[model samples]
Target: MTDVVQNGQAKRVSNSAIFAGCAVFVAGMVGAAYASVPLYRLFCQVTGYNGTTQRVEQYSEKILDRTIQVTFDANISSGLNWEFKPARMVNPKIGETIQIEYTATNRSPRPTTGSAVFNVTPMEAGAYFNKVECFCFTEQTLQPGETVKMPVVFYVDPEIAKADETRNIKTITLSYTFYPSEPGKPVAALPEGNKAVDKKL
Candidate 1:
């Protein structure tokens, strides 16, 4: 009887250990699923995969005479009540930095915050498009009936003219879509001393 009881106790302990191991495995999988999105985004940004452009502090001083036409597109998702558009189309020489403004107006009666997701096309051109400064880098908040002008600084890498796939590409379109931020996330506050312009569209 003593031997039988000892065996039973050992079996119970083994079972508990197995159950704990399974629980830990499941928890790890859940954590990995949550982390995958940001990890993939980081990977794309670094490799310029999927038309994701690279962010740069500055470009080379040499400007190639090859020019490319850049078109801008702005969109607001279903829940965001705002009017957005690019100021104009621009054509710039490769490696020459250019700045442009986008205007957005909040039509809602209450403060609204938005974050933008952007991409460049055609896909091959993404690896060559570099942005120095862009509004898409941060979340934007607009007060009721407020209108704001945002700027983007960018350049086409001169190396693009050497890439056989994109060398002859004449135009690239940069598109941005604004969406409501996730719930409970902190909304970025507007810069101090900048009064909201109550210009409703």
Candidate 2:
């Protein structure tokens, strides 16, 4: 009787351990799946500052009377291997549409595909800005030694020009960086916006 009871207790302990392990595994899988989308988005935003989501705005324009023309600049960081350029630096007037063009070449021997994300920090009135052409949202693939010209079309809102906070604004900077694509992932594509005759480079 004692032997049988002992064996039964041992079997119950083993079964409990197995059940707990299975539950933990299932919970982990569920948590991972639930967090995947948000995690991916966070990664993209941090890596490139894609400017898809709106950020908190803090505008100050105490120098409205100063001689300053709102200018836009570009910055390319390290770790991303490519050549880049800007089509325009200073937009003449509010609501004026301008194109910023850049050429990217794959420096590595292997075919490369990745997304270019950007951030625009304009003077106080920059929030009224609208982008008509943007490659930042789409993933681009380049064969070795191949180069492609990318364009971003944007206009500053007229309201910004009239705003008290932006009256003295002189420049806005748009910066971008690229990152490697995950293996076996489908290329992410974004629809192109309003078309303009871009100077073929």
Candidate 3:
């Protein structure tokens, strides 16, 4: 009888260990996907983790013969009534500098200010992505119906071609999401399917 009890206890412990392993595996799979912005600023700016692009001043020293398509995407989080978008796409050679623009207009009846957070993908590409000039994190205040153009200057590092993890990338996407510059409000993920709104008052 004691042997039977001991065997049952061992089986229960084994099952508990299996369950804990499964939980850990699931958590690992979901690592930082929900961390969104600010995390990019705090933990990713230097290391470029979670697809956060690096900021630099000088242009790349070496331009490559290879070209990669760079795409742009924009989003507006809640509490901001602004329309923003990039100026389409460009295929830039590795280490070659390029400049692009994004237009933003206040759609609200009153003046509003917004800030931007940016990142790039296939996650690992962040370490190789470099931006020279950007309007991110700056407060832009526009009067009612006021529109303004913002430019971004950036390039992909030539070292990307040599890095084993990013060498195969053919396309990279640079994305930004704008949020209200209201003090004390926490930044959050953008809502789906609402890039441009007819919410003009």
lDDT tens digits by residue: candidate 2, 20-80: 9999999999999877766766654333234332221232322222333334344445655
Q: How do the predictions measure up, each by TM-score? A: 0.87, 0.56, 0.71
Deviation in angstroms for 51 in model 2?
7.2
Over 36-122, each residue of candidate 3 has an lDDT whose tens digit, in order, gives 454645567788888988878689999999999999999999889899878798999999999888888899999887767778988
In candidate 2, which residue ranges exceed 4 Å CA deviation? 1-79, 122-126, 183-200
RMSD of each: 4.7, 7.5, 9.1
* lDDT winner: 1
User: Once model 3 is optimally superposed onto the true structure by TM-score, how far is the C-alpha of residue 99 displaced, in angstroms?
Assistant: 0.5
Comparing 1 and 3 by lDDT, which wins?
1
Q: Write the per-residue lDDT of candidate 1 for residues 1-201, one digit (tens) a residue.
A: 999999999999999999999999999999998777777777777777788887877766879977899999899999999999875889999999998888998999999888778888997888889987777777778889888887878899998989899889999998888887753452332111222332333
Off by over 4 Å in 3: 1-40, 183-201
Q: List the residue pairs that clash in candidate 2.
A: 69-170, 70-170, 70-171, 71-170, 71-171, 71-172
| lDDT leaderboard ranking | 1, 3, 2
Clashes of each: 0, 6, 0
Alpha carbon lDDT of each predicted model? 0.81, 0.57, 0.80
